[model samples]
Target: MRVAIVTESFLPALNGVTTSVCKVLESLRAQGHDALVIAPGTSPWSPTMTPEHYAGFPVHSVTSVPVRQFRVGLPSYEIETVLHRFRPDVMHVASPFVLGVRGLTAARALGIPSVAIYQTDMPSYIRQHSGPAGDLTARAAWRWIRRIHQQADLTLAPSSAALQDLAAHDVPRIAQWGRGVDSDLFHPARRTDPGTAALRARLAPRGETLLGYVGRLAPEKELHRLVELARVPGTRLVLVGEGPSSEMLAASLPGAVFLGRREGEDLARAYAAFDVFVHTGTRETFGQTIQEAAAAGLPVVAPARGGPLDLVEVGVTGDLFDPDRPGDLAAKVAPLVGPEAAELRERMGLAARDRVVTRSWPALVEQLLDHYALAIRDFSRSVA
Candidate 1:
């Protein structure tokens, strides 16, 4: 089947949503399905913008302009005009942005079923960053999202937590479309890298421990907590991404090493470079980075809340710390600081890799195809 994916963010940006979509598209193509992607001309998540191609898909760019406090690209009507000619069997809208709204409109005009994926909690984001206008911001976001998603043939959520949240917001016909990890690319074996050896030697030259965080250095990530974990003397913190908050975070935690953003083999090596992986965010619908960390055979330390709760099996894969206490995160990760921690890391990392391998991209794409078939059947009958 041919499928068209519409997301407000893509290639030029690096985030969970964009990454997941790319992986799924590749997986679908491997299974003999055709897929096309449409994304914003400029990404709000990254500063350096460059257009690129993916192996299995073609991407089209829409509007390039600033929206609200951030610069974002709007949807191009020409995209819809082109997709109409191609006539995909299904259209999936990945974000509840203007592009996504256009996806729904275009799909409706073509009498084709469309699915919307609830990837982020815009309401919560507004509440966190909208200052005193947070209440108005949240309400506005809720209204906008409801209008955009209510008409979708099915709404896909990455986690059960997200499903419950969307239900509360009155989103209709929801289905689970959990994110997956590339077991082949992110396994413990990929950790072999000159860069990893070099970084490890410098940070733990005298046998200090390495603790890592891999994702955007944005306000929503709760990275301050990760920085605070650096108080433990024998631990060297490695942050593997850059965002608006990178400079401030670098200043706040002087001992921490910022490696910018690494992708493919480089990213896997970075994950394996660390003794333990840490996450403090409570807002993730699903944490693909956490899964990638696990796939690299690294024990994880994350909040007991959000997607990590679903991925990290406490005392088995990794320990879950109390989100309220950054100190608890430090304590949970401290065991790995000792020499004995190396054995634990290997054992836990193996288990972590095993768990993530089960969520492979091909399997996830096939499952989503099943959901599409089901949605089409149900909607066709309803209309009949």
Candidate 2:
């Protein structure tokens, strides 16, 4: 099958959308499927860094403008031209916003079926980043999102919360499709690896419990919520990844150890070194980092909302705190910290790993292909 992936973000942008797109492309390549990527050009911050290709597939970059630390792809006739030439069996629109809207329009014009993947929680993002006009802007963003997804033959949401959100916004033809983790890369064995152990010792030098959080250190993440968690007795906070809120978060978090952005083995080692994984963000459409942390055999402590609701199995695998209650985070994390809870943490960590062990990228990609087939059939029926 030939597929065309039109994404809001891609290479050089280390976010959830980019990570999932890369995994999908890799899976498609391994399965003997032909695929191509249409994404924004490299941001001005990293002018020459974006790749011309990925997963052995050609990546056609469109003109883009900088938005904060990231680039946003603009609407272009290039999308129609690329789709016309590729003659894709299905078009995959990843996190439909500006670029995605154009991709969906082009697909409709060419009589091609398209699947819109709902990954980002834009309404919540608008509310978080838009200052006082946040509520009004968020309502407008929801309307925009509804129109964009309604254009696609099928819309795949990454979690139950996302699927429900789309349905509530009156977006049609919705389905649930979650992200996968690399169990081999993020495994229990890594905890004992020399490098990982050394890293853990460095972070928790005084035999303190290492509580970790991975992903961008941005405002929307609510990293400030961790101030109380950082103050927990017998626990040390470790943060991975970088973003616009880094310096501010560092100052507010006090003694928390920041590891910046890490990838591949380095990222895996960081996860393995953690005694517990804590996620502060309440607006995630799907918590990909939670899956990675769980795969690394760490008990997760995340907000009792959104994607984490589907990933963390409460007391069995980890714990979930009420996002509305600010102090709930510290309360939830307490059980997974300190030497007295070591056995409980270990059992929960093993359960967490077990929950995600079968959720491989290849398996998730197969599910996506099934969605594509459904979209194709739905489109054909509509035309007939």
Candidate 3:
């Protein structure tokens, strides 16, 4: 099968959308399917570098303009031209916003089926970044999101909470499709690896419990929630990524250890070194990092909202805290920390690993192909 993926972010951008798109492209290549990427051109974030191809597939960069810290792809005649040449079996639109809307329109013009993947929680993000006009802007963002997904042959949401949100907004033809983790890369064995153990000792010199959080250190992530955990006795907060809010978060989270950005083996080591994985973000459509931590054999502590609701088995794998209640996060985390709770943490970590062990990228990609087949059938029927 030939697939054309039009994404809002890709390559040099290290976010959830980019990571998932890369995995899909790799899977498509391994399965002997042809695929290509359409993404924004080089941006301020990585102005000096942008790959021409990835995973042996061509990456066509469209003209883009900077929007705050990231680049936003503009509507281009190049999209239709590229589609006309490739003549894809189906179009995969990832996190459709400006570029995605154009891709869907082009697919319709060429009589091609398109699948829109809903990855980000734009409404909540708008509310977080839009200042006093937050609520109003968020509503407008929802309207735009609804319009985009409504046009697709099928819309794929990453979690049940996200699926319900789309259904509530009246977006049609929705299905739940979650992200997968690399169990081989992020495994329970990494905890004892020499490098990981050394790193863990450095972070928790006095045998303090390491509670880690991975992902961008941005405002929307709600990292400030970690302040309560920071004050917890016998616990140390370890942040594993960098973003616009890095300096501010560092100042606010005094005792926290910030490990700028770690990828591949380094990232896996960081996760393995932690006693518990804590995700403070309340607005995630799907918490990909939570899955990584689970695969690394660490119990999770996340808000009882969004994607965590589907991932954490509460008590069995990890615990969930009420995002609305003050100190609830620290309270939820207390049970899994300290030397007294070592046995409980180990049991929960093993259970966490068990939950995600079967969810490899290839298996999830096969499910994605099933969604693509459904889209093709639906599109064919609509025209008939």
Candidate 4:
């Protein structure tokens, strides 16, 4: 099938949405299907920049605004024209915000099957950014989001919990379209890298337990609570990512190591070097970093909320503590710092790796194609 993907985020800016879009496009090319991407980019045509291509497929780079210190493209005016020429069998939109909203509308006008992946927890994010008055803004955003999504053939949520939230909000045609991890890139084998040892040593001086957190250093992530984790005796909090929240987080989390965004082998080493992975984001639709940590053989200690609830297997793959309960995070992670630390760490780490073995990109893309076929069939039936 020819798929037209209009995304809010893409290359030159790294995040879960960018990573997932690249993976899907790669899979589409490998399976001999036509796919095109429309996203915001940092001047691939600029004098300093070399062109950015994904799996030999062309990307229609457009202008976008900065969100969480990254560029998020507004929908292009030429999208309808582009879709007209491509005549896509389906339209797959990632985080149906600006670009996606337009893409879904065009898909309807063109009478094509379309699916919108609800990735961001924008309602909660709006509240975080708006304070007490943001509730009205969040409600308005939700209504707008629901309006756009209701036009699509289907809405693909990243997890069951996320789908539940969408369903509760009266968004129809909700289904689960999960995320995948690169096992080869992020594996236990990468831990033996000399860089890994150097990183651990640098982050945790004098043999402090190295606890890691990956993803944007934003308020929505609730990273301020990381100060609480750092207070846990002999534990060092090492954050791997950059955001506007950096300076403030650094000032508050004194002595905690801020590696400021590591990618490729460096990112894998960062994850493997940590003793335990702690996630504080309660609004994640699909925690990509959590899966990457699991693949790197680090047991996760996440709040019992949102995407972590679906990804983490308590006591086996990781531990889940109720973040609503004060000190619950400390209580769950306490055992890892105790006398049986060695045994529990090894057991949890191994299980963490074992659990995500099937979460390969190929398997996920195949499942996605299945959904596309179903959506197409259902859409055709409805239109007929």
Candidate 5:
């Protein structure tokens, strides 16, 4: 089957959506299926890709602008011509926003069956970064999202929680489609790598514990709460991504180390450097970084909300703190570290890695392909 994927995020823009699409595309082609990508890219657009990068797949790179608030693509249109040439059996929208909306609209007009994945919790994000009246803006965004996703033959949610949220929004034809991690790339062994060791020394020369957060440095991340961790002596807080919040975060958390953004092996090693992997984003629809952290064998501490609830097994793999409780995050993390805590931390880290083994990409991709086939059949029957 031929599939066309349209997403606002893509390569060179490090985030969950871009990485998820790249992984999906690679898996699709390996299974003897052709895939076409429509995503935002640099100034010079390319119709065809080189085998060296992106598996040499056909990608329609659109000229794009940076979203004012966040460091993500807001692609301008040209999806129609790409869709015309590719003529795919089905379309997949990786969180329909600027570019995805165009691709979905074109697919509907061309009578092509499409599937949309609710990768981001946009309404929650709006409430995060949109200042006062944020709640109202988020409500409005949810309605807009519902209107767009209902056009698809199927809407895939990463978690049951997300599906429930979508159902409340009255978006039909929804199903579960979770994220996966590469354990091979992010294993416990990497913790001892020369580069990772060097990083650990650089970040915490005084033997301070490293509490790390990986992903976009956006307002929605609620990094301000990390200040609470700073109060815990003999520990250093590090952020591993770049965004509009970089300046604000650096200013607010002066003691925290900002590693900018790291990808590929560098990213994996960065994960290994953390003594504890912490997630600050309470609104995450699916925490890919949390999965990666688990794969890296780092004990996680996250809010008892959204995606982490699906990933972290309390007291088994990692601990989940109540988002509503004061100092709940600190209390949960307190037990995972300190002089008397090494044994417990190691046990939990190993457990975390073990749990991530079950979320295999091949299985997830096959499931996605099955969804594509089902969506196509349903679409054909309805159109007939």
Candidate 6:
């Protein structure tokens, strides 16, 4: 099947949505399907970049400019035109941004089937950005998002938690797309890197804990908790990505080490190098980073909310703390700091890899193809 993926965020930008989209595209291409990507022309993360090939997939670039410290791409006319010419059997929208909405519009006009992947919590994002007017902004966005997604043949969610949130907002035609981790790339064996040991030694002295958070440094991440975590005696936080709030976050937490953005082996090493994987973000739909940490044979310390709640098996995988309290985060992470945590890490790490094997890219891509077939059949029936 020929598939077209439309997303606002992609390569050069480091985030869960971008990584997940890349994985899906890779999986589809591996199955011998013709897949195309429509992404922002200029990456917000890296300014000195142009249209580039991404891991063999052809990405169609569109006009983009900075918005709120990040790049936002305007709608692409060429994407619609290309879809008209190629006429992909299925189209997937990763976000309800302008690019994704345009893809939805094009698919509609062509009488083609489309699926919208709900990757972010837009309402939560609005609340994070809008402040005093956040509720109004969230409500308006909720309506707009509903309009875009209600037209989808089916809406794919990466987790059941995500589906429940969408259902609360009255979103229809929802199904689970789930998420998977590459065990080969993120196994416990990657921890043998000599550099990781040296790096750990450099970061911590005789008796200090190294808690890691690896994801976009955006407003919604609740990184304020990291600052509080830093207040814990004998603890240091290492943030392994960059984003809109890097400067402010740096100011707030002087002790934290910001590693900008990392990819491939470097990223895997970052996950493996950590003593405990701490995730404070409550808005994640599936929290891919947490899963990656799990794959690295690391125990996770996250809020007992949203995606983490579903992924972390409490005491077994790691401890889940109250989302509202920073103290809870500190409390959960404090225990895993000492020597006996090694056995806990080994146990959780094995279980984490086991949990992700069933959701392999091959299994997911096949399921996605099934969805595409259903969408096409429904579209054909509608046309008839």
TM-scores for candidates 1 onward, in order: 0.93, 0.98, 0.98, 0.95, 0.93, 0.94
Could you give candidate 5's per-residue lDDT for residues 1-384 as a string of tens digits? 989988877766667887899899888878888988877765444333212247557777676664663234454446777788889999999988777888788998888999999988989877777889998999999999998897889999998788889999999999999987888999889988999999999998998778889988877788777867866777889889998888988888878999987888999999999989999778988899999999999999998988888889999888998877878888888777675777887899899999887787877999999999999999999989
What value of lDDT does candidate 1 attain over all alpha carbons?
0.81
Backbone clashes under 3 angstroms, per model: 1, 0, 0, 0, 0, 0
Which candidate's lDDT is highest?
3
Off by over 4 Å in 4: 43-52
Model 1 Cα shift for residue 9 (angstroms) = 0.8
What TM-score quantifies how close candidate 6 is to the native fold? 0.94
Q: Which sections of candidate 1 miss by over 4 Å?
A: 42-53, 67-71, 192-195
RMSD to native for every prediction?
Answer: 2.6, 1.1, 1.2, 1.9, 2.7, 2.1
Could you tell me how far off, in angstroms, the CA of residue 261 lies in candidate 2 after the best superposition?
A: 0.5
* Per-residue accuracy of model 3 over 1-384 as CA lDDT, tens digit each: 999999999878789999999999989999999998999889546656568999999999998887866778998888999999999999999999999999999999999999999999999999988899999999999999999998899999999999999999999999999998999999989988999999998999999999999999898999989999976899999999989999998899898999998999999999999999999999999999999999999999999999999999989999999999999999999988899999999999999999999999999999999999999999999999
Candidate ordering by lDDT (highest first): 3, 2, 4, 5, 1, 6
Poorly placed runs, candidate 5 (over 4 Å)? 44-53, 69-77
* Residue 259 lDDT in candidate 4: 88
Candidate 2 lDDT over 1-384, as tens digits, reads 999999999988899999999999999999999999999997556756678999999999998988887889999998999999999999999998999999999999999999999999989988988899999999999999988988999999989988888888899999999998999999989988999989988999999999999999888898889997865899999999999999898888888999999999999999999999999899999999999999999999999899999999989999999988868899988877788999999999999999999999999999999999999999999999
Question: Model 4 Cα displacement at 285 (Å)?
Answer: 0.8
For model 4, state the Cα shift of residue 184 in Å.
1.3
Which sections of candidate 6 miss by over 4 Å? 43-47, 50-52
- Residue-level lDDT tens digits of model 6 in 1-384: 888888888766666777778888888777778878888877546656644666577888788887765567788678778787777888988876677888898888887799888988888888878979999999998898888898888898878888898898899888888777787787788768887777777777665667899988877898888766875677778899888789999999988888888888888878777878999898888898888888887888888778887788877778888978648888888777766666766777677666665666678778888888888887788788
Q: Scored by Cα lDDT, where does model 6 land?
A: 0.81
